[model samples]
Target chain A: MSVTAAKGFTAAGIAAGIKENGNPDLALVVNNGPRRAAAGVFTSNRVKAAPVLWSEQVLASGQVSAVVLNSGGANACTGPKGFQDTHATAEKAAEVLGRGAIEVAVCSTGLIGVLLPMDKLLPGVETAAAQLSEHGGEKAAIAIKTTDTVHKTAVAEGDGWTVGGMAKGAGMLAPGLATMLVVITTDADVDSAVLDEALRAATRVTFDRVDSDGCMSTNDTVLLLASGASGVTPEYGEFADAVKTVCADLARQLIGDAEGASKDIRIEVVGAATEDDAVEVGRSIARNNLLKCALHGEDPNWGRVLSAIGTTSAAFEPDQLNVAINGVWVCKNGGVGEDRDKVDMRYREVHIVADLAAGEATATIWTNDLTADYVHENSAYSS
Target chain B: MSVTAAKGFTAAGIAAGIKENGNPDLALVVNNGPRRAAAGVFTSNRVKAAPVLWSEQVLASGQVSAVVLNSGGANACTGPKGFQDTHATAEKAAEVLGRGAIEVAVCSTGLIGVLLPMDKLLPGVETAAAQLSEHGGEKAAIAIKTTDTVHKTAVAEGDGWTVGGMAKGAGMLAPGLATMLVVITTDADVDSAVLDEALRAATRVTFDRVDSDGCMSTNDTVLLLASGASGVTPEYGEFADAVKTVCADLARQLIGDAEGASKDIRIEVVGAATEDDAVEVGRSIARNNLLKCALHGEDPNWGRVLSAIGTTSAAFEPDQLNVAINGVWVCKNGGVGEDRDKVDMRYREVHIVADLAAGEATATIWTNDLTADYVHENSAYSS
Candidate 1:
């Protein structure tokens, strides 16, 4: 199924004169039905943005009918003015959609500590509502991006159930949703409790595991809305599968668009004594900047990989670990093995498979390369 | 008590034609034989260099007389031949110094995975050993350089005893000892076991606390030599003080020379309820690339600081936290308190003080500003 295949979700994308570039910067998605059962996940950063605070309160009521997101101004660390901007955004969206302000969620991304331009924002909201369409899912995905080069969205349908999601993030990717902004819409007739459960589970194994640079963002958010437009009630297994598929797809897209990222690395850790050990090993490799830089240089420096894994608290001894990069066994039992030239990291996507040689537990983590553009963007960003 | 003032240690630095720029790359420091007790602390990384392995084995015997180090080739990841090269280096140094091979320690720094050119290396060692002098400490400090802009040296004197050291590293700084090569000398009467105790205690609170980047390295080593040439067996308190002071000074110098660093940030976490909590809290801020970049921009973004603290397991409520930047209390009790304009991070140094308002435990971490040069250096380094 495609992004537009999700039921009851009408989306719109519009240029709101909010960004320096004329890229689509305003997006709106609404649940047309009366049902507004929703569950939300916000960034774990304590220094949260005003929209995050407002949406966190809104989610407490277990109801959300609409989500209005704008790029180009993060409305973060702007004090009282930032809070007022999020409120005004929700209120303006509610006025256009004929819904209560409390039922409308709002998100903003881009330059932080800036006030939203209401003169541009209010008119933009009306235009988005008027421009709403069933095929606007991809457009909505494009509108909520900052450094991302492509829009990310995924949908899966089975047993008359559907799940569609769009995500935006390219840098500052690490832990607690990874500075990524995601919006999901579903019509599986699930309650808020199950939606919460499914979203958390999917995120734990998907978005939360994607650590590009190990930098957490303050404005990251993931929202899930179940409009219940589809009459069939899917079992937990099917619904969970649908959620996981969307998450995995969006996760892959995020890695692909990682800033200055010439390589998208999938680190799979297997044969750990426990699932936690597997996760620990995966995370150790994922956040290693030296290894990431080595990957960007397309050098299969397996020794760097093993050095990162050795730092973990996992029970596996270093001598029992085996690492294969790009389908070549570069190291075995803690010693250098075959020719390093057999591994190729030149591809935009690369896979690093590690065997702990212990128990049968396993895990995977996705990350990006270390690049000059990443440093350029970060150092020159605020300036 | 300056570097060259250590007893029985004659040092030299020379341009042995290792780096393309023709900077000094060969260094030597010899114990003039009143005592020869040695202790070493190496990087925890499992992927060690040939020099690291040889030194670890030699350190196991707790007997060493001299250390010969060079810059511009890490002698790492070059396979079995690398190990043989390191052994040959020790044997050569021992032959020239009229000492046993097992009594000579060797350290190499520079690019990883490259074989050391023994052509320049052998003659360079001969020149360094022949020209060693009591006043060559500064030159020796400059010899073992990589990306560092300046040499780092620290010294302390107490009750007729002297402690001195030199170090080099500009990147890959993190917990469990910053990724730099260090050699320390002392004239105190101490056995290998006692020297280990003193060195470990000093590094635990000094070099290990200065975490510029969260990346550990494979070639990090800290070697301590006690010659007892001054005939001074001072009190333990005096010896500990000397070690701590020398280490702290070296830690400061490492921060000052960090790659792409504009401002040196010192994060002090106080009343953290536990030493581990204090260290965790300080490290969270020290390793933050965003926070470091903000420091580069001279933006007193205390919000980022508070959020970093919240990410730790410091056992304090967010509201009980207070943050001060450059002596200005920017955040009080988890909220903005004063005008951030009063805070200035533009100097060569910056200070951030976080009060957990719990117990009296405290920790301080030194780090460098995030800048474009760091990225440029790492990205093109392997190329």
Candidate 2:
């Protein structure tokens, strides 16, 4: 179950001819309920896509009826015309759903600096609106894929309430929001302020920590919509936890299916002075290209890890650092400790723990190994 | 002519067996002069190599007699034992050169977290000292090679003084000094204070601006030695310009010979509000992996350039950014401008010009294109 797994939600996926290969390229998700409450988070990148700009304004009103997303074009850096196309898309979606244009949110992903096919996209909006159903969540999840090898969806159940989400992203995934497009739905009695607080808190520790390649995208977005059809108010704490669970699950899926990645490396930074310090150290290690390549080669090279940490401003003396790969403490007190040969890395999943020996806080980041396939895929991506 | 192009310097390179493959791995350079003024710059990385720690102390007195460098191992993160080895190497050089240990400098490059073979290293220093010659600069340059395909050397001659230098680096090249080991010598009549001022000013614009792969090395070092053998007290401005020219030439060579790189990309950021902003923008573009890969594939993907800029805090509106790839204005006003098909990227050197349209300041950063061979070379480097 995806977005439609929650009560009072309808979704549809259809081929819009936007993708020249004839794949399903349009997805529509709607919340039909007693309450129309919504919250959204967008890419922090200064050069945002046209849809992201439009949707940010829509979320300002704290309510949304439907979300329309496409996979064939990003509609970014397309000049003023790009913003116009996004406005037209929301108008068309609102007209078909019998809602106001301001209530429709739009998202687009694919190559940047390209204009969407308006003729096909506008007509496909009507087709998707007519086919909307409660069981169309899986198809909707599949329709918003670019380089993704698999669809990502998650569901978290609570007392008399449920939260469901679908995500689409592969490459250009990095912090400040991974290059993703996600839509989440909930059937709980809640206001927009509560939804906003829950969504931000959940995403801050989940999707915000997944950095696949250290390349941020201009089209990243995450939206949460509440229908309030269950007629049962959930404890705010419990609702937020459920949202975090689903978001965390989707973040893991994004890392596992990262383009051209052969190994998914999890880096945990412990003993930091603060959570921010832990995150800073974790991100430094996650973005080190040399370390990622060594992970792909299955070589337990801990020196690169220390070098990467050295570049950061976190509070730690060089001699007070310790690192463990898999289960072996290969480096202790910043020197060689255990035999590197004993650190097995034959599995697809690799775990690394870095102890700063400075404090008690900790953080974890998920990333992928850099392989020849990664270079090949990205080198030929736009060509 | 390399370092020995200066009248008062003698150099030697030898196969000391520090490397298992039996390549030349040790080099010694001596300033036998009326003046022993020196200045040095080291890696800004917090986890410095033992040699960097040792040499920083030696240069504190602004006087040096000899420098001993090894290419087989970088004595970093080896704890007290690594620092002890660096001290012992300096003592050996001082003993052979009839100078104090406090006047001897040391440098090392290659794998980190490994101890040097003091057994072969100390004895090799004596042999190198005995074999030192005024014409051994070429051999000294060749001895410092780790993954470099060719030895890099440059010389600048004034009316009665001359400056010459040699550098060795391939990968793990980034700013905070470009992850390279360099030794420069001058026979001009200049004091240690003057040499320090000139060295820092020249490198701030040259070596520190070349970011090949965005990986900072723990063993980066650059030294400038002055011996008043020429007896020519030239103007300081003329002398500084000569030093900058030679450094710029060497920096270009390092980018051209970067490990596994197919293209040398020069990113020049113009129309910035400040010099620092220009440098920051240029460095950001230089370190962008997606942009580097696109250049390797000979594709003019300007959107990647904008995305990289978006991540920085540089001053510029989104719609005011313009990018030119190889003389083709593919992106203007943050949108598609000239036809991308008109661009031709057939040469080994790729030029990218980004105009922020904010002010007049500009800075250029040189980097290498990302390729599969870079991943392959680094993956098997430690193994």
Candidate 3:
């Protein structure tokens, strides 16, 4: 179950003839609820797609009756025409769902700088709306995939309420809202302000910490909708925790399905002077191509880890740093410690711990190893 | 004509058994002159190699009678022992050349965290010193190769004085003193301060702007030695220009021979509010993995370029940005412009011009496209 796992939500996925390959390319999710509260987080990139620009305005009303997403063309860099297409899409969704146009949020993915086939997409929206069902969450999840090999969805259950989310991203997966589209729906009694607070707090530690390729996308967006169909309002902290749990699960799935990755690496920075320091150090290691390649090759090259840390301005002395990879303390006091050959690398998951020895603050960032397949896949992605 | 193209300098290269492959791994360059003036630049990496730490101290004296460098093991992260090994290497070089230990600068490259075999290295210093000759410049350049496919050398001749240099690096190339070991010799009648100013100025635009793979090494070193043997003091501007020309030539060579690179990408950022803004934008593009991979596939994916520019803090309106690849303006006014199909990408050199439309400042950064070969080379390098 994805968004439809929650109460009073109907979802549908359909082929819109927009993808030349004849794949499912259109998805529609409508919140038929007693309460229509919504919040959204979009890509931090300044060059946003047309859908993001339109959805940003829609979210300001603190109400969303429906969300419509497409996977054949990202309405980005199409100038004024692209924005018009996105506006028209929202209008069509609003008309079909019998709601205000300003209450519809739009999301689009696939090739950048390409305009949507409005003739196919607009018709597909009506078809998707007609076929919408409470059990159509999986179909909606699958329809948003670009290069992803599998669909991703997560659910967190609370007292008489549930939160469900679906995400799609396979590349350009850096932080700052990540390069993905996500939709989370909850059947809980909440206002727009509470939904907004919970969504931001959940995404801050989950989606914002997953940096698979260090390339941010221009069309990333995450939306949360509350229907209040369950009528049971949980504690604010408990509700926020449930939302975070679903987001974290989805974020983990995103990293696991990152394009052409051979290993999923989790970098944990401990003893940082502050949480920001930990994040900065973690991102530095996550983005170091040399270290990523070494991780791919299963070589416990702690020197590269040190080199990456050295590039950061975090508070740490060279001799005070320590690194442990795969439970092996390969480097200690900024020098070789254990025999690197003793480190095991047969597993697909690698854990690296970098101790800054500066303070007690810590943070963890998830990323994937650099591989020839990653290079090959991205080299030919847009072709 | 490498370092020996200038007067009063002799060089030699020899196999020291440091590399298991039996490649030449030792080089020595001596300056027999009426003036011993030297200037040096090293990697900004905080975890510097032993040689960089040692050489940094040596250059502080503004005199260097001899220089020694070796490949096969970067004497970094060996703690006090690594520093001791570098000190011993310099002392051995000084003993062989009959100069003070403080007058000997050292450099080392290859895998980090490994201590050099001092027994073999010290003996090799004597062998290299005995074989030092004016004609050995090319041999010395050859000995410094690590992952480099070929040795690189550049020479610029003035009215009477000349500047010649050698560089070796095939990976881990980035800014803040690129990941390479370079040695330049000049016969101009200039003081250490003048040489320092000229070297820094030359490197700021040349070596410091070449960002191949964006992985800075801990052992980068560029040393300039002036013997004043020509007895001709060229104008400061003329001398600085000559130094910059040679450095630029070497930087281009490094990019051309970058490990597994199928394309050399030159990212020129113009219409910036300041030079810093231009450089920042240029570097952001150069370090973008998705754009590099797209370039490797010869795909004119200007959307990736716009996304990269959007990540920078440089002054620019998203709608005012423009990008041209190879001569075709694929993106203009932050939207699709000329037909991307009209862009040609059959050449190894790809030129990308990003017009920020913010101001008049401009900067260019050279980088290599990401490819499968690069992944393969770096993945198994340390193993």
Candidate 4:
């Protein structure tokens, strides 16, 4: 059901000719509610897209009733004209939904440094608004895709309330929200402040830890909208847990569908002196290209893992470190421990445990193996 | 001529049966000098190899009589046994050369986390020492090859003094000395203090800027030995410039011979508010795998460059950035400028210029393109 899994949401997807190949490239979602509360997070990249800039302001007001999103052009690095186009898109969506322009949000994704086809995009917003229905959520999920092999959606049920979301990303997925556009909805009686806190807490551990390629994009955005249709404001912890569950599900889906990947690697860092140190160490191991290629070839190259760890400022002595691959302690005391041939690598999911042996803090990062197909896909993407 | 191009130096290369394929795997360079003053630099990685740990101590005395290098195994991450083996190798070299064990340095390269074959290596040291000759520098260079396609050698002559060096490295090259074993021999009359300052200054701008694959190795070493045989005490400035030229030459060769790479990218960052910022921006651009792949496909995708620049903490506004590819301005004022089609990328060398429009500081970094062949080579390496 995607976003419509929540009680007070309707959505639609439409083909707007924004994509040259005639794929559906536009989507709209409306929240009919007793309360219009929303929160958002965008890419940490300094060079943000125009739509990201526009939606940031809209989200600042802490209220939103409608959202318009499109794929096929990122509208990034297009200067002042791109900002105007994004503003115009929000205005068109607000007019079609019979709401004020300040109550609308906008998002865009695809090739960077290109302008959107506003002539087609503005009219498609009207068509999408007219076709919005509770059953249109899945279609809306499918519209915002570029290089993604499949659409991703997830939902979590609470006591008389629910949380649901949709995500689209396949490449350039790293920290700062994973280079995607995500829209999550909830049908609980929560204000904008609670929504903001829960969303930030959830994404901090979910989307922020999925580092597919260590390349952060310029047009990433994640928004959360709330409606009072359920009339039940659960405890803050319960609401945050639901949001985290949905975000983790969507983040996992993003990794599973990473571009040209054959294996999804879960790098778990253990026994760190601090959470930040664990995360830094995990990200370093996740970004080691040689190690990723070794894993892709089914070779348990723990030395590459140690080399990656050595490059970081994490707290650990080289001789005190240990590593396990698929539950086999291949490296102990920073040296060869078990026979590398004993480690199995025939599964699509690989688990690597790096023991820093510092204190007790831990962190996990999800990434993919480097492959020839990945090089081919990204090499020919912009051409 | 290589290291032996300078006076009072003798070297030899020998096959020790350490490699399963019977390739030359042992080399010895002896400085038969009136003055044996020396200086050395090593990898900044915390998880250093056993030989690096051993040689760092030898360099502390500021006098080195000989250096023994092997190519069959790196002897890294091997615990106490690895350090003992490194000490044993140095002891054998010192015994054969009639010097103290503390005056001998050892260097190893190849697969990490494995022990060298002591039975073959110790006896091979005797054979290499007996065969040492004034004209054996080329053979010494060849014996240190692991995955390198060619032996690297460079020479810089000043007045009556000469500086010459040999290096071997082909992969795992990044900042902190380019993941190679280098031996520089000079006949100029200089003290250890002068050699230390010159070596550090030379490597800071040359070897430290070559980031081939963004993977720093655990066993990078560069040693400079002065024999004082030429009897020409050149100025420190002239000696330093000569050392820098030789290092630059060898660094370029390492980039040219990077494993499975087809294109060499020279990223130059200009108009930075500080030199550190320029270096940070240049390295960020050079290590961008997406941009490297795009360049491999001959696509002048300036957006990826801007995206990389945005990730750094450099002082530059988004709207003030400009990028040039192969002398064509593809991006101006952070937006699209000239036609990307006008940039020619048909050659093996690709130049990228990023203008921060902040100040006049600049830096250059050399890297290699991401290729399917690189993935294939690394994936099947350790098996």
lDDT of 1 by residue, B223-307 (tens): 9899888898878777878888888888888888887778888899997899999999899888776677667767777766766
Q: List the residue pairs that clash in candidate 4.
A: none
lDDT (Cα, 0-100) at A253 in candidate 2: 96
List TM-score per model, in order. Answer: 0.87, 0.99, 0.99, 0.99
Candidate 4 docking band: medium
lDDT (Cα atoms) of all candidates against the true structure? 0.83, 0.93, 0.93, 0.93
Chain B TM-scores per candidate, in order, are 0.95, 0.99, 0.99, 0.99
Off by over 4 Å in 2: none
Q: DockQ of each candidate's interface versus the true one?
A: 0.35, 0.74, 0.78, 0.78
lDDT of 3 by residue, A58-114 (tens): 999899999999998888888999999999999999888889999999999988888
Interface C-alpha root-mean-square deviation, candidates in order: 3.4, 1.2, 1.2, 1.1
Pick the winner on TM-score between candidates 1 and 3.
3
User: How high is the TM-score of chain A in each model?
Assistant: 0.95, 0.99, 0.99, 0.99
The whole-model C-alpha lDDT of candidate 2 against the native structure comes to 0.93
Residue B62 lDDT in candidate 4: 97
DockQ of 2: 0.74
Per-residue lDDT tens digits of candidate 2, residues B1-383?
99999999999999999999999999999999989999998999998989999999999999988899899999998999999999999999999899999999999998887889999999999999999999999999999999999999999999999999999989888898977999999999899999999999999999999998888889999999998899997799999998998889899999989989999999999999999999998988887788888888898999999999988899999999999999999999999889999999999999999999999999999999988999888888872
For candidate 1, the clash count comes to: 0
Model 3, B246-319: lDDT tens digits are 99999999999999999999999999999999999999999999989989988999999999998889999988
